[model samples]
Target: MTRTARSRALGSRPARSRTARQHAVGLAALLLLVAAAPASASATPSPASSPARHLEGTLPSGAAYMIDTPDHWNGTVLLFSHGYRPEGSPNPAVNAPDEPTKQLLLKEGYALVGSSYATTGWSVEQAVPDQLAALDAFTKEVGAARRTLAWGQSLGGLITTTIAERYPGRIDGSLSMCGLVHGGVANWNSTLDATFALRTLLAPGAGDADVRLTGFKDAADAAASAKRLGETLGTAQNSADGRARIALAAALHAIPGWNDPRTPRPAPDDYPAQQANQYTAVRGLVAQPGFAWRAEAERRAGGNMSWNTGVDYSAMLARSSQYKEVKALYKSAGLSLRDDLRALARAPRVSAEPRAVRYMADHAAPSGRLDKPQLTIHTTGDALVPVRTESAYRQAVAEAGRSPLLRQAYTENAGHCTFSPGEQLAAVHTIDHRLTSGSWGDTSPSALNSRAQQADPTTEARYTTFRPGPYPRPFRGQGLFG
Candidate 1:
């Protein structure tokens, strides 16, 4: 996502045939929306329970999407925009919300809508407008009032925040989860950190050695260093350094040789899991001379470089003033920052949907409001989004005197949506409270906590069983990235 011009984000799913009961539940929800509408309703959008309607269309860019509408939409609408996919693909409208979210929204009479935002090739600027357009189309067709709620996950989160800032009164509430708020700053910083790590792996005992790639004139020297780096990777992976090992594997996977240049990598292939295991396996054999077998294998196979990694890294590194001072970090990591920087500048600019960009551009502060209440949630330990981004944004908003309109929730020991039932229910309740009352509730334990503490194990098990599966369609070839 960082490498891609338009930043998108997140994971995958499993398939189970829909059940009769499920269909019944959906139908029931739809009927309620239609029946609940006010007879005298005029242009003002009001909440109603209607069966969700799916709409599809082509955007100006020729990008297409399928959007799902949860029926009986209370004019209070929720729109989710997905983050960037390295493949530059768009997401289906219903990308990230869980089953619980759908049920809760439907039962609450909230209309939930999502779309793939036309072409994935467009950046957030284009995608955000497309979403707005989609909403316009939906309003005309459904006759729902214009009062709305906008939200997105990762890249979608980025889009939502920008919209919230830009659109002001147009949006009632905004939620962005694990989005890249700092743009070039965050991307460049992370890349420098990665390069630094790589350098450390290469020069184990020589930790004091500078990571100057210029010193190495040819493939032989670079390959030798790469071999050393591989051994370090092996050691780290095998030494019970869980996070470090995961980080290394993730960085490697991000590079060209490890991943498929085409097509979004699905979640189920467990690419990260596989990469970790592969590193572990190779690490076990590093004591054997010529232990950098994998790195050597890659070189022998022509080491086809990925276009995104180096190019994006260079673009960010150049744009970021901080990266300039941190150049030594790369030098210590044994990488040629100068060469990569030049090469990336000359590379083509990646394209992305304009909707997200427009949303961000519109909502930027000094020009936006600070009166509406907003709640942001992000897993503290998220490797992908890097929790720092969330914290930084909150700080920025607070510093801007918008603290009254902003609040943040941190999920513990969770991945993207991998929260415990207590966490999920607590979040749902919080959102409901904010939407219904326009106020973040006073500090108090939630119903979910009480239930978790005293409820019967059988009931608890049943509730847990209903939890949404990880990445709804992981390998089904149906994601924004795919």
Candidate 2:
């Protein structure tokens, strides 16, 4: 999905106690690092005069990493993991989200590091290990970090969370921004639901030209099929039935209808406007070739990893938070929800290859067993990674009995990872405070907004209270795709 669509699709804080021994260890480590550096090197410099130590190297696994440590070492290393890059796209070599944030962090004396995974295109398996390897490289090439924080955006957010859970002792804290924390099964199935609805509702008999849920031969073919479906949906949007169907599809996945941050969210009774926004999101889904990632994911997994077999549209909708909106839209259009449900029931269902499903679970799903402090940030208006991901993750963490270990924040923007330098700094500082104090500080939206404003006046103005709807069809491991 485009950043706009991702922002539109989806949409916390506290304090605690600290252990003296742990605090002493962390402090001692920091002091040791500072003492080891040349005394003169500890002096901060102006942005124009700052000299950062830069290092770049390739890991044995073929992943490349870059590390930047400012002249004034802060003893904290921000190990950034980047988001997904389509298989054929160029990979980024740096870890920072934006130049402004990068400079701000460096100017504040924080070290930054990141890795371009061994392979691209949803390679979460490679990313997790590659990122760890990059950190190892950092320790050898530079020096031991007094504290390390795993941070990432989008797919990288998943990687960051995984690292925290899998290797808690390796890092002190983690920050995940706009991550797909709901796991690959939930993410792909959500997309599948939307695409299947579009095909069943509008282009049912298009045959070979229709978008393929699986079995794509290549990226070009996947893109072409997505384009075809998008074009069909575009024309279909002119009618009430088409628009209602689009809303139904989006709701099944709990996709939000606020893609543009500049515009206010549609009011509860504004069915027409809501559907219009949903159509744009749906259009962006297929038009931007959002579904193309499914093909790439399947290719990497060696087969299909998603399915709709045994899925009951009625049951699914009943569980969806978007059900009310779907019902309202259908009623306004004088459409029969039962009839649409029947149509969905009659459509041929897709099934997943068992191995592929396992591959996704192993690489893309979080265990939700938080062993260290972790914080997540998402824009309430992000359509690409959807706020539903945060909701699903919260459920998982609660289920694991580790709710207190995790906290979440939201930006009032409408684009994917559309955080300003101030917002980014606020989140980083929040994590840093938690690590040092061993308890969360004030993490309320108002508190965070205040901090962000103080850090940068240009910060986006929408950091108000909001909660994301439930993620429709959260992954439950083994039997999820059956």
Candidate 3:
């Protein structure tokens, strides 16, 4: 008999202190590099700049928010949306990414404000509204700015884009970093492709076919499921065929072999080191945070919102960034790549409940009908939220006839939300320039790098001109992108 995927019963959120930012939302999922740290110790405020006026409060919806306005206001206010908060992490109602970045922006005369969404786990439903409410509150507190710009990291990046699409008149322009820009349905569904590959090729015993993929009864249920997958991944690492299969699974999600932001990227041909890194990288991702993300999304969307009914595994491998790696590894292990994909083809497929897909599309997905100008940036080697998100969003935007409104850039770095203070400031300045000049200036990698180094010499800014491949599993199904 097949074990059930998830219990229909809803789960309770883990109690957490309102403190440090949760890694799930941040998606720098692992490896925090001190070298990437910005806000240099030697830097001092400009003589013309003064400390910001700080204000904090709770919205009527119960979301806490904070605002900071410099003494010399620039007639601009940046509305920040934070990443998704895991169910049971220490979440602080924060607006800015770091104290230094905040100070640098304020010192440069820009005001900033952000809200801790009404509730934590998978806050997309309330995140945009909470942010809009915070914007209203900010306007009431200090009068309306000349213009408002929206910006966010990770899930907040999705929220930032949603605001532009749904309520553009409220803001002039926006920026999204390391965002799940493809939409919620695509997120879950594509991830299902990756996890499905893992289970089919590497599951110990009966495999994760028995594991709960969604509608988790609670965080523990999701976590326990994640644990099983992690253990499977661990055991698979010790064998040649297992490593090859791991490469295939990682490729499905565009999981990079390079894991840390602080460390230099692995040489392109170093397949062994890369595969080993992928093993470690994917292990952390399959943990509680990853499954819990799906669980919370399911809880919000009303059911299993992801499926893999007709995804072409062969085509998916063809489009993967790590396609060559998978092939090379398979040959090294004397495994037939064709055989495994055929097995995946024969494996039982998962289907989504119609209601969940509809709910997720309306609230959590990007329609690509961009109303305001958008500047998106991503780290090239981002493990959790791959750079392909930008690629897919660009396709969606081009299809929507809104390509002119979006400008995408990439960092020659790894990890999620790992931008330095200078790089972060550079994005703000770039978007601000567009909003002001009514034209996107030279946004080339070299130009951005120059701008970042000029802003914060202490931080590194390695921008690159890159074109990401096709999104492996887009939600071309009805009720979304239709």
Candidate 4:
């Protein structure tokens, strides 16, 4: 079925609950004030029909973990790493994407495990060790598995990859779904580029002197800045020139033209519609208040972790897949591309503090040294975590001389982490097949789609053959963020 029809069937998404925000605040306060002490595992009896052993406990670092072992004992454990949660957000009891997927894996005889992490909000450094502690705790309490797979979503994707790279002997394979594998430096700098362009082209007289780009002291300040920028973009979208400018900014980062999952992908030449969709993504999702993970990242790293110094917009434009659309929009709007490029060149650029850069490099950026088979999946129209991340990651893997060990898949759908149960299962099965057979199987789109259909008829159709455009603002080398 078409995306529009599916969207109509699903209807509009609900707003975030106030209770959730409140819980986050409470959790954040508790974590900051209290010191964590080592704790032992607590075992719970499983259902009679399931016959699985469930264990829960806290680590010395104060992170909580959950483990499920089926009675059949498949000798394989799947370590699940969850996506980023804002500081103060309530910790999850289990990190699986969906309960159905969890149950299916358990029934299939795979053990499930995940940790809450030591502290929240851009805590990859803490997570790496904390997750290791969880694994060690699992081994100590439940005995070692014959094989283990590192599986994570979003930021957890990065963690999963890091585990495989840093401790290859501990993991047999890895799967990263909708992950920011491109690293913190490139991802957040790309975000800064979009926000900077918005402020410069649309709200030139804000008078805060680029404070919107870097002066976030807290969530409230970040929210206020995001609100102002969002309102400006909304007003600018009314004019042809304004829309063209938005396209240029989005193209700079290879932002997708699909934002609303309820809508279908725009036709290639539909610049106005495309820009409109991108504007909704930037303003509503990327620039939203709760979406301000950068502030926390900066605070943790001791200063700004992103920089756009020495960037050449012309060169970036030349590399972007959206260049054709951008050129078309500019020409139709009677605007000069040269003039926009000049404006970007003349704008004040942001730079990162050295210590902050080092922190991110040590804690977040992936070395791309793959020691085992790894698979990645992304939606073609993802806005929050952009499909360009997949492209950036592919480049990193290639540069590390591990291209043979990496495989990527794509879906035609929009939104972040929007995979269906069937799609998720198909990915897991693909990795499992490789591990079990000691050779990669038929991972073609048609084959995966067929597998998904068999598992769940309601699964969204797959677009595994889709190749994402190049990441326009990729980090070139270690010098920038290392």
Q: Work out the TM-score per prediction.
A: 0.53, 0.85, 0.87, 0.85
**How are the candidates ranked when ordered by TM-score, highest leading?**
3, 2, 4, 1
The C-alpha lDDT values of all candidates are 0.46, 0.81, 0.82, 0.78
Worst 10 residues of 1 by lDDT: 473-482
lDDT of 1 by residue, 229-334 (tens): 5555655544333323333423321221112212233343334443443343233333221122222222322331111223344443443322322343334445
Model 4 pairs in collision: 24-88, 24-89
- Give lDDT tens digits, candidate 4, residues 1-482: 00011111466877869998899899988976643534334332222233367778888888888888776767778888888888889985465788888877777788888889988778888888877877787787667777888899988988888788888987899999999898777777888778777777777655443346764677777777777777777888888888888888888767778766888778887877888888877765446422377778878989877778888988888888778888988898899988988888887777777888788777778888898999999988777788888888899889999998898998878888888888988888888888899877888898888878776777575756888777766553357642
Q: After TM-score superposition, what is the CA distance of residue 206 in candidate 1 from its true location, in Å?
A: 13
* Candidate 1 Cα errors over 4 Å, as ranges: 1-52, 88-91, 182-184, 200-232, 235-371, 420-429, 443-482
TM-score of 2: 0.85
Backbone clash count for every predicted candidate, in the order shown: 56, 16, 3, 2
477 Cα displacement, candidate 1 (Å): 36
What does candidate 3's lDDT look like per residue over 1-482, in tens digits? 01112224579977765454474545564435544557684553342243346778888888888888887888888999999777766665687888888888888889889989988888888888889999998877667677899999998998998999999999999999889898777777777777788888887344444676656787778888888887888888999999999899889878887867766678999999899878877787787445877887788888888888776889888978798899999999999999999998888878888888888877887878888889999998887788888888898899999999999999888788899999999999999999889999899999898889888889888888898887766644464331
